[model samples]
Target chain A: QNSDASNEPHTVKKSVLATYYHRKFEGRRTSSGAKYRAKKLTAAHRTLPFGTMITVTNPDNGKSVKVKVNDRGPFSRKLAIDLSESAAKEIGIYSKGVAKVKLSYTLE
Target chain B: QNSDASNEPHTVKKSVLATYYHRKFEGRRTSSGAKYRAKKLTAAHRTLPFGTMITVTNPDNGKSVKVKVNDRGPFSRKLAIDLSESAAKEIGIYSKGVAKVKLSYTLE
Candidate 1:
């Protein structure tokens, strides 16, 4: 049944463990050539293209923040995303260090 | 004896209290029209022009970081500069939340 797939919701959502960037790493250049700022709403993903925008929501508090994927990696196999401190804070994970987050991305 | 004012180290340096931006402000629009990122090496000052690069040094530890002025702030009478979390972290202020910093600006 060749139904139109384009008509379906294009937003991709997933659940993953989200952690923040180390504060010590701030000012260091990122893989994207932009210096890492723990205060920016940006994140590092294993494979997402740079500039990819994602909405990360903390399942515990329902708070969400939009971030641009500008770098790569959580490095650990268990964590799916590494967020900047600001991004983590927006989703209520700044103090806890890590949290389970729902990631949503829409196709442009 | 006006020998050479231009050659006599045109870098202006000052000691001021530097604080980090509130994490809640991440993703908000900065005065420069760019989103405020606590993770970027950016800062807010009461009068510095946007994009003015300044070097911030921690007097207690001697650690330093370079940041660009991108917003206007530090409304507090005691604080002279407002740094992003990453900027603060770079100069060893992230953990303490505030610090006595040496600010140096070089003129072109």
Candidate 2:
């Protein structure tokens, strides 16, 4: 009985197509009702609840960033999450427009 | 200057010992005068200025988190940055209490 294991958060991991928000989206209200700021570390998921935090990683470069889910996005079923401009840049994919990333989220 | 390169943000990178805020600091006012909330992705740095955002990565685990510099100090010269609870958790160092992390910040 490893009690600490149960006490710790449970994680659900997935591989997804990552894209970033455009500057135009700045000042727009997100699904969570928060204004989307290009420089904030935030993201959008199809169905994750507001305030859910996810660790997104570009495995190729081992670059990762934790982003808060504050909107619903990517709209295309093929894409998983839409990262904020700053979040994407941190993972070295802002200029690329898109990339494959590993998403790790905890159930809290 | 390559026009695009000049227009792009510049990065400042460093390796630091990362510690996280304790639950007791849940409602305390940070140096930036904002109440510290453990669930929010935020961090404290000695001199990066308020509102600066940093991408912190645990290289060993390839996990990272983007946190805003909303507070000040670990107070110890040997320590570099103080991350929030959720941020630390995202990087798999919540229970560890401390770890070495690579910090990347963009100068816009």
- Cα-based lDDT for every prediction: 0.52, 0.53
Question: Model 1 Cα displacement at A105 (Å)?
Answer: 39
lDDT of 2 by residue, B37-64 (tens): 7667776554355677666664545656
Where does candidate 1 stray beyond 4 Å? A1-9, A77-108, B1-108
Residue A74 CA displacement from its true place in model 2, Å: 1.0
Candidate 2 DockQ, CA atoms: 0.03
Candidate 2 Cα errors over 4 Å, as ranges: A1-8, A77-108, B1-108
C-alpha RMSD over true interface residues, each candidate: 21.7, 21.4
True contacts kept of each: 0.04, 0.01
Q: Model 1: clashing residue pairs?
A: A37-B39, A37-B40, A38-B38, A38-B39, A39-B37, A39-B38, A39-B39, A40-B37, A40-B38, A40-B39
Chain A TM-score for each candidate, in the given order?
0.61, 0.62
Per-residue error for A90 in candidate 1, Å, reads 47
Put down candidate 2 lDDT per residue, A84-107, tens digits, no spaces. 334444555445544555443211
